[model samples]
Target: MAGPLLDIEGLNVDFLTDQGWVTVVRDVSLSVAPGETVGLVGESGSGKTITSLSVMRLVPDPPGRITGGSIRFDGRDLLTLPERAMRQVRGNDIAMVFQESMTSLNPAFTIGDQIAEAVRHHLGLGRRAAVDRAVEVLDLVGIPAPRDRVDHYPHEFSGGMRQRAAIAMALACEPRLLIADEPTTALDVTVQAQVLELLRSLQQRLGMAMLFITHNLGVVADVCDRVSVMYAGQVVEVADVVDLFEAPAHPYTEGLLRSMPQLGVRGEPLATIPGNPPLPWAMPEGCRFHPRCPYATDACRSGAPALTERGGGHFSRCLRLAEIELTGAV
Candidate 1:
């Protein structure tokens, strides 16, 4: 609804390994506008989390590093900011709700303490004001009796309640952008639906940008305004929610859509991509998904295609996107 809030270009992340510095995220680019939600969909080890971490300058330094890229948040280049300045921006201007809320919260602290601590640190609120703000935020996120539950420890809360608390903490600072990495991965169906709806409502109310990372396509369709399909370490396709589901532009996106059980014939096993993603250190020579692509040809096997727009904001990185007749066969 508003102007662009975050813009990332040519993001390259690498990890130092026995094989040398292996590229993890390659030339990755994405953007999120104010009050909009963008989904980054990919399987495990596809560098989705790494790409988000890089935006926050949270990449582990010794073994992992951001080799190149320009992360622009609110038109300011984050990569160029000094550590102290970046620390001030992180949490104050942008927040993240990482996967595995159980592990993300400190077992020793109360939900209120954690959330209030963020407000205290980032917004310079007094102890009482921070605690009051925490209660307000908890209630804002649909937490019942926030005043009573404020003293509950992480272990005392249910899985869904703890996740709500995690979101409450992330929103404590009223950040302009929220990066949620697989926040609903471990929830049950009911809770997952609740969380998704909660996210949509919160975004609408607060007018904050959200970059949601997940491997679930269903979630993307339900909550994302736009979606990007990531494979190996690069984005293969990006399109509006309706456009992507109607007709995915890349072979990998097609395979993923066909693999969903909802689209499969009754009583038949769900379709699946044939192979695991290539190791970042041992990536194939050309298109990363060529080995698994059903319509891969010589061009696909020998030369990777750069991302190109097809029209109406749809983009794909397949050399034969136009040439092949991909029918989404399971």
Candidate 2:
């Protein structure tokens, strides 16, 4: 395997509460090679977003803290880096497109100004050159009439356009790694397809690695080279997209695949997992997903299973992985 662009090992993020420190992410580990797109998928509150935030070192400080593990980007361990050095690496070497463009974008600033700010800060371009580059990136992201729309505020653009603009800002510096946290959550199917396609095209053109976070299996199938299924802050499975879709080793992953609406099965009820995901403060002691997992056994309920390789580079954290087959139960 090629050297990873981003490598995470035994990563554990915690939140300090009145009671004590609660671990939200538990021993999660994964890596992304240069130009490779990795998908982190799970239901809401599954710690997918927090994992990405930890990598960017943007976790809320009052309560949140990275208690253990190392996040290495390129060759440096980011956890030990100073705030000043981390800032320099953030937008220049690794950029992120947040889940909600509305919350991330500045309401007071024009779209052009926002994009130009990133360009100027990272590339040190003069104002005029930054604006020009901003327009170029906007055009590249498929924004029509970039020159006119550049002057419009975030509110002036439609939801889809705002998302594209947000993506444009992320790509403005041509960073080596791009972390997109649910980038297509608010868009319609048509617009979502366009945005996903644009991301794929840009990735190929720029040869940049991507950490694509989403709950949509369809989106993962369309863009991700590898898929990591997360549950209650732990990575239950990781595999190439083809291997994962064809023969998912983890019950949680099989459940998610079965839950996706299929074209030929219109009248059938959508499949669902048995229980809700555990809260950060109250995660289960053993396998976090065992309560909802149909194939779970006594061992699954008593002790958490470490992620181990099954076959074809697929790794699963289920104790019954060797006994279970992919029968597709949501």
Candidate 3:
């Protein structure tokens, strides 16, 4: 409720490829207030993962780099911070739950040892204290028989359990800002629901701000306070969860919404966005989504449209948003 815990402006991340330096994230901006949950939604290759990595400063620099923009956390410029300072900030101030839990956890180390190692190294707690903290977090994350299971190896736990253990490790430092990138990927429906609920509960209890990067609109509807829709590395739309769902302003967002399986259209063919997402090396001239936009016009194929405010803090990046909004979701 105070100020933005994380403020990103004009963020540009580029990757050196065979073609040249290709921008994966282009002039992207976002923010997370204290204890607020903001969802970053996009299909794969839309640069969601890289954007999150940029914040954590985990983008492999030789291949990928933050070419432009500022990532400010708690009023400090993370881009300007030294490696040692950034290392201190990574686990302590900003923690990330990578896309998959299985590969992120070490098969050799027991779950307790991994979580305790973070606490021990970051919080400087003693071995005994770190282990206690690990047990406590495991219990907090709803892991059954935490005292015993905490010592189990990653492979020893079930898929859902391993995911829970991963979340427990991320929360071990009790970081102020938690970045979860597709945390529920490949999870069964029941387990996904449970994991999401646990995350919500833990965030509330700890009063932490969360930047949730996911492709699930249903999940976004359930948990996110605000939603940012990304397309071709740029944020196309941003609004409250209800606003974005009920009255999507950007065509890309509408296409995404229309693609969701609706109860009324149970047996019918599901709606899908036309055309493939633009490749980073061969990006379209104007709006990146224009190629797939059913409502695209001459203007859309020319100069790029700027992100414009659309009443009550809602924003959209489209050349003809007014007309498209009147026509409604595709």
Candidate 4:
């Protein structure tokens, strides 16, 4: 197989709060192949967003810092790269469509201007050429009347339209990798479906890899080729989407799957995982999910489990993984 387009190893991120330094992401690692769509799924506050921000080296300063890790893009170590060089790579090589388009877009600038700036900077196109290319991208993302809407401000567009514009900007330069952090969070179901289908079509057309982060399992199954389940700042399991749904290896993965409401099981209560994710500053020792895992044993309390390969490229980080039944009931 070809090398990964993006490779992250031993990645750790920390924030310096009034209470002192606290680790938020711990020894996490993941990769994306060229043109592959990988989903990062977890409940809210499970560190999914932060992980994507870390990849872009966009973690806010004065508090957060990447203490340890190697972020390699196309075999080049990004962490060691100079800030000036990294800046050139950001929007050019790895662009991101943030969760909220309302907050991400610049209210002062026209949507076309914002995208044109990216294209001009990266592709060295003149103002008129960049604007033309921006409109072209907007059309590619299924935004009708691209010529007319290109000059409109972000606030002028509806919620779903704004998201499509944001996505258009991210794809303006045909980036090698795109990190979409909850791209459809605020949209209605119909709009969400449209945006997801657009992304899938664009991915195939552009031949670009994607790191799609979302809490929606249904979305993961629909778009992702592989899924990585995160819990308490660590990846609990990584597997193909079918394997994950059919036979989840980690207890946390099982819990998440079981929690989804089924259509025919009306009288039965929806299954749920017990307890909340531990606070980043106060994460428990050893296995983070052991406290709530039904199959947890004494060993789980004393030592963190290594992410071991189970089979078929599936990996899990649970000592009692062998003991847990997929039925999700102890």
lDDT of 3 by residue, 1-330 (tens): 667999999999999999999999999999999999999999999999999999989999899989899999999999999999999998888998876677989999999999999899999999999999999999999888999988899999888888889889999999999999998876889999999999999999999999999998989987899999999899999998888888889988888888888676566898889889999999999988989999999899997999999999799998897776532332
Per-prediction TM-score: 0.97, 0.97, 0.97, 0.97
Write model 4 residue lDDT over 271-312, tens digit each, in one string: 888888888878888899988888888899899899999999
**TM-score between candidate 1 and the true structure:** 0.97
- With a 3 Å backbone cut-off (N, CA, C), the pairs that clash in candidate 1 are none
lDDT of 1: 0.91
RMSD of each: 1.6, 1.5, 1.4, 1.7
Please, what are the lDDT tens digits per residue for candidate 1 over residues 10-64? 9999999999999999999998988789999999999999999999999999899
Q: Score residue 236 of candidate 4 by CA lDDT.
A: 87
Q: Give me candidate 3's TM-score against the actual structure.
A: 0.97
Higher-lDDT candidate of 1 and 2? 2
What TM-score does candidate 4 reach?
A: 0.97
- For model 2, the stretches where C-alpha displacement exceeds 4 angstroms are 328-330
Write the number of the candidate with greater lDDT, choosing between 3 and 4. 3
Tens digits of per-residue lDDT, candidate 2, 10-44, equal 99998898768988888989899999999999889
Scored by lDDT, model 2 comes in at 0.91
